[model samples]
Target: MDEKTCRFLPAWDPVLRFLHWWNAAAMTAMAATGIIFMVCGPDLPEGTEDALVSIHASVGFLFGAGVLARIIWLFIGTETARWTDMLPISAHHRKVFADTVRFYLRGFRGETPLYLAHNSFAGPVYLGFFVLAAVQVASGSSMLGLPEEIRSKSMAQELHATVFLLLLLYIIAHLVAVFIHEIAEKRGIVSAMIHGKKTFTDDERDSILEAHPLAQKGDFDERKD
Candidate 1:
């Protein structure tokens, strides 16, 4: 296993990538429409606000469906897609999280730990996103048919706006971190989401897959001769 040599292995599965990009598109649409309402104050000329609301609601429903499917997949999807792999609660994962923080603190100058799927630090952040998405979906759903007066003052409305802001912040931070990780590690972090593969050195790959059996490549055999 030469230090310069690397192996391309499975990271995200097909279903995971599809749901990821689908939700990303849906969120972008929701954010666009939401920003319009926030900027124009819901008093757009004629029926413009209504039209935006329709678009927002339709996209929100699709986002909600995608979120639901993702949650279900966390239970039944591939090993990398499962909840166990995405929670940063284990001792090993906590160490990975600490090392990741140090990697950032050092200005991306040193070697960072390798992960086949979501990095340990990112796993919990993703879980938080799902929680925020759930709240966003529930609050938005509750406002669907309510009277304008109640809708304006409802708890649902408040939660919806707050979750939107939180998600906006999350998106900004996520993008920055991803870009930095891609540049620093040269691991194809951005492209991996699209192609479901990541490059790892032979030693890194073997050690990671061996430590986390579930992270083993789906098509790779582990049986000893």
Candidate 2:
């Protein structure tokens, strides 16, 4: 039988918590722009059209900065924030990821792996979406930065339009994944990222960090992936 999820486990470090919440807030702003950008499509109230695009561009810039800061922190940040922690590490991990997928797809949770930080099962899913977010934002920024002549550039237009289309699809996929993960798995992961702590069963916690002496220490948690 599965251990009940903990209501009070220490989850993320302070820095990790800060960045996560900050990024989430930025993402919300980006999401708003995403909707407006899609529906409005260069259309705005007569007096505020330019103002709206400017706001969109400014928000894009802010989100881009957040993304860049995250990259730098990925290199110099705390545990639970490193690239490796976010990605799968072994065959067992691959299996866990696959099983998680199968569990979601087939509506069966039998034999799923337990994870402390990123569940081996969900690791790749998180990594994939993060990558998609990075690409979407990058292409979105390029689109927003259309210098007069570059505005008409075929490559710029293609990148801007194509990335937007793909980003829309990715957003839908991301939301669906979150809802499914939440419903079937009973993990409020999206809200956890907001709250900055998730409870793990006692054994699951130990088994995961036991292999890495360094990971257990807050001092060494900042080491590169």
Per TM-score, the best of the predicted structures is: 1
User: After aligning candidate 2 to the native by TM-score, how far in Å is the CA of 113 from where it should be?
Assistant: 3.4
- Tens-place lDDT per residue, model 1, 58-141, is 999999999999999999998889888877766656667888989978888787866778788899889999989989999999
Model 2 has an lDDT value of 0.60
- Candidate 2 lDDT, tens digit per residue, 89-117? 75545655766777766665554444445
Candidate 1 lands at a TM-score of 0.91
Which stretches in model 1 have alpha-carbon errors above 4 Å? Answer: 1-4, 216-225
Q: Judge candidate 1 against the unseen true structure and give its global Cα lDDT, from 0 to 1.
A: 0.84
lDDT of each: 0.84, 0.60
TM-score of each: 0.91, 0.72
